[model samples]
Structures are given as C-alpha cells and as structure tokens.
Target: MPQRLVAVSFNAPTSELAGRVTGQGATLRDIPGTLFLGGGVPVAVDGTSIAGIGVGGAPSGDLDEKYARAGLATIR
Candidate 1:
C-alpha cells in the first residue's frame, strides 16, 4: 500500500505514542504516503513500561519519518 496512506500502529508510550501515527499525515495533502509503525500493543504509562518503537516506511527517509509519526499518532 502507499506508505503515506498506510498506517501501522504498535505499542505506544502513553505520553508520546500518538505523534508518529495519524495527526500530521491525516492533513498533509502533499505527502505521497504514510507508513505508521507499531506493534499492536498499548504503551505502558509507567516509566518501567516497555518502549514502543517502530519506523515509518516510504520511498525516502524524510517520508519514512513522516509516516512513522503517523502510526504513532494512532496510539491512544
């Protein structure tokens, strides 16, 4: 699927898991696509909570970053 249009959601730290998922890409009309990355788990709110991390996929590194952020945006 188109990277910008694709959104992959994984575990997210309660505080920061939402930025890289859907907020920006949902509105950015210029972006070719979005690849939101995630592990399908909820990021623990506690510091001891595991780190929810993943990378956005795209033709370019910049686009990848954007998509990665899109996925994170999906986190609750």
Candidate 2:
C-alpha cells in the first residue's frame, strides 16, 4: 500500500501525533513521502506529508512520532 500521513497543515502537530501512537506501544519511523503532500502508514498523523510527519514539518523529532498514535486513538 501507499504511505500516507494525516495532517492538517504543514505545521500540524505531527510529532505529537506520532508520539501518541507510539505511547500506546507502537513504533514509527520518519521516512520519505510517497506523494508531494505527506504520507505514511495507514494510521499516520500527516497523510499529506511529502516525507512523513517528523521528516517533513514535524516541530520536534520525537514529537511528530507521538502525534500519529494519538490521532489514531481518537478514531477508535
């Protein structure tokens, strides 16, 4: 499948989202982006990311990782 990150804007709290997902005990890495916007795993924080949340516009390195999980948790 294609990678995608679910983010609002370039400054979206992506690190925050990734960290959240990881907080639940999941591991995510900041890799290149598939599309020009943003993208990652099915459950990513910034889906339009051109290079994953943390890799693209993540405020902090780890913060972006945390946000992804948190965002997904809200869905469930």
Q: How many pairs collide in each candidate, listed in order?
A: 24, 38
- Candidate 2 lDDT by residue in tens digits, 26-66: 24433344232232223333444233222335664444345
- Model 1, 1-76: lDDT tens per residue? 2332232223332123334444544543333543333322233454333434334345555454554556657774
* Residue-pair clash count for candidate 2: 38
Instruction: Name the lDDT value of residue 75 in candidate 2.
Output: 67
Cα lDDT, all candidates: 0.38, 0.38
Query: What is the alpha-carbon lDDT for the whole of candidate 1?
Result: 0.38
lDDT accuracy of residue 56 in candidate 1: 35
TM-scores for the candidates: 0.30, 0.30
Model 2 residue runs over 4 Å out of place are 1-39, 44-56
